[model samples]
Target: MPNGEERPISYASRSLTKAEVNYAQIEKEALGIVFGVRKFHQYLYERRFTLMTDHKPLVKIFGPKTNLPAMAAVRIHRWSVELCAYQYDIQYKRSEDHGNADMLSRLPDGQEQETEEEKVCFSYINDMPVSAADIAKETKKDQTLSKVLQFTLNGWPSHTEDTRLKPYFQRKEEITVDAGVLQWGIRVIIPATFRKQLLNELHENHLGINKTKAIARSYVYWPNLDDDIEAMIKD
Candidate 1:
């Protein structure tokens, strides 16, 4: 169509899987466009094209520099990276002007069925079910972890040779607290997000409860951590 011919090049449409259906409208739209490019990479890769969508926020996101808001999840960040493989201009089109895409979006498809093996491989239960708010609250109660959380969120103080939190200071840049959730690199701080999952990993391997407690102590700390690990293993 770059040559001005009315003829089309490629077309594709498919119902999103269950996980995708739960995405916000902006995420869904961005995914659809990204999927389209991937599906037609032979035609789209290295070639300039215009990706029209009804979501205006997508325009800003795909721009050269993006100040992703706090509400933007890591999922959005991943999707943005996936979109970088192509050269395209994201333009907003009115819903009325968006024709076939609107109809395809409404086309119903059956839910995806997952096998038993899939279930075993993917347990949705999070190990640490703690929220950012809970992390903040807990930090206020514990002087040590609170200092660690604050140091991770804000900048750590200079000169900490005598401090017990020397290890944290050494790796301060890699550790961060975003949206009240402390993260050590990509792995969330186990205090709240993946506590249960980590415990299960230890228990499933029959790593003795004491060993698990030792492992937790080396990297992280919270009140009753040993008790929590023991309970998870018992379950």
Candidate 2:
């Protein structure tokens, strides 16, 4: 930043190769650091700038005086060594706070030809309206769902399979409740059948896919939720 204002010097994005796409999450993250530095080494080689990443594990593995992790894969070892050439510090930022990379990763193929206005911009909303409050109340009214909701609001036991909460047993491990709101990690956990209705409520604002997804990220959880949103918008 020159004169205390942030300025963009250079940026790059690319599709992951088939091999890269198949890597485990950790390896993919490691490769990203490697690739980013290699791409910008000329500019970065002589200067020191902190490296920021949402992947906390990368920070642990690369920190000073840290020994090579015993169970680390061979690929990780090589990447860790490569990072040693740089003068930098590793800092952690939450994934939700790191949207650009996440958005870039979600880009559909053939997006290169799309104009800047076409990217990160949305034209319209195609979702039906639904009441989020009514749905939440009704879902909470169910005896089975209530227990899960309470557990989320209060706290869940470390151990699972409580017979009283049997209905949640199948996916109990995926459940999370924060600030009186139930979530499946970052995804909000709601009744399976009501997902589309909830998505519609979240999407009805015509807020663009990423913005809608961001709204959903704060309150809902489901498998393939992002993909479902994209399909819902298109359909």
RMSD to truth, every model: 12.5, 17.2
Question: Which residue segments of model 2 deviate by more than 4 Å?
Answer: 2-5, 99-235
Please write out the lDDT profile of model 2 over residues 103-140, one tens digit for every residue. 44455443224334322211111122434444456557
lDDT of each prediction vs. the true structure?
A: 0.59, 0.60
Highest-TM-score candidate: 1
Candidate 2, TM-score vs. the true structure?
0.42
Question: Which is the leading candidate under lDDT?
Answer: 2
Candidate 2's error at 182, in angstroms?
33
Off by over 4 Å in 1: 1-8, 99-125, 129-235
Q: What is the lDDT of residue 182 in candidate 1?
A: 48
Question: What C-alpha lDDT does candidate 2 achieve relative to the native structure?
Answer: 0.60
TM-score of 1: 0.45
